[model samples]
Target: MTHITVDLPETVFSALRKTPDEFAQEMRVAAAIKWYELGQISQSKAAEIAGLSRAEFINALFRYQVSPCQYTEAELARELSDAD
Candidate 1:
């Protein structure tokens, strides 16, 4: 894995000191979920970015109330047709 450094405000770092790793992990998960919600990335890519396996990421999405499914209009139409 490539290592990158992020500079956080002293106050933010101080607050994160109690559980820095957990804080960072939560932030990554939130960012990944937000990106996926905005259709900016696929579920697998978002999961990778969140440092979670696909199933774990999907579960996280449910825990966070973020839907993991993407449904386009055409896809919805196809589903409706298949139901007929």
Candidate 2:
């Protein structure tokens, strides 16, 4: 595993009420979710990046208020029509 280091003010942890470890975990998940939302990465790739299982990542989507589906309206319509 590769390790990345970032520097932040000590107050940042207290502001978020998280320990450094917890903050690190949250940062990873936040980045993964944002990237997934932006369509820069697939859900599975985001989950892997966040160190979460696929199911857990889907649940995290709800917590982050991001849609788990990556489909556009047109794609969804096509899929529905194909299913019929």
> lDDT values of the candidates?
0.88, 0.98
Instruction: Report the C-alpha lDDT of model 2 over 6-48, residue by residue, as the tens digit.
Output: 9999999999999999999999999999999999999999999
Poorly placed runs, candidate 1 (over 4 Å): 10-18, 72-74, 82-84
Clashing residue pairs found in predicted model 2: none
lDDT by residue (1-76, candidate 1, tens digit) is: 8876777666775766736667778889999999998999999999999999999999999998987887778998
After best superposition, candidate 1 residue 31: deviation in angstroms? 0.9
Q: How close to the true structure is residue 11 of candidate 1, measured as C-alpha lDDT?
A: 76
Question: Model 1, residue 48: displacement in angstroms?
Answer: 0.8
TM-score of 2: 0.94
Q: Best candidate per lDDT, number?
A: 2
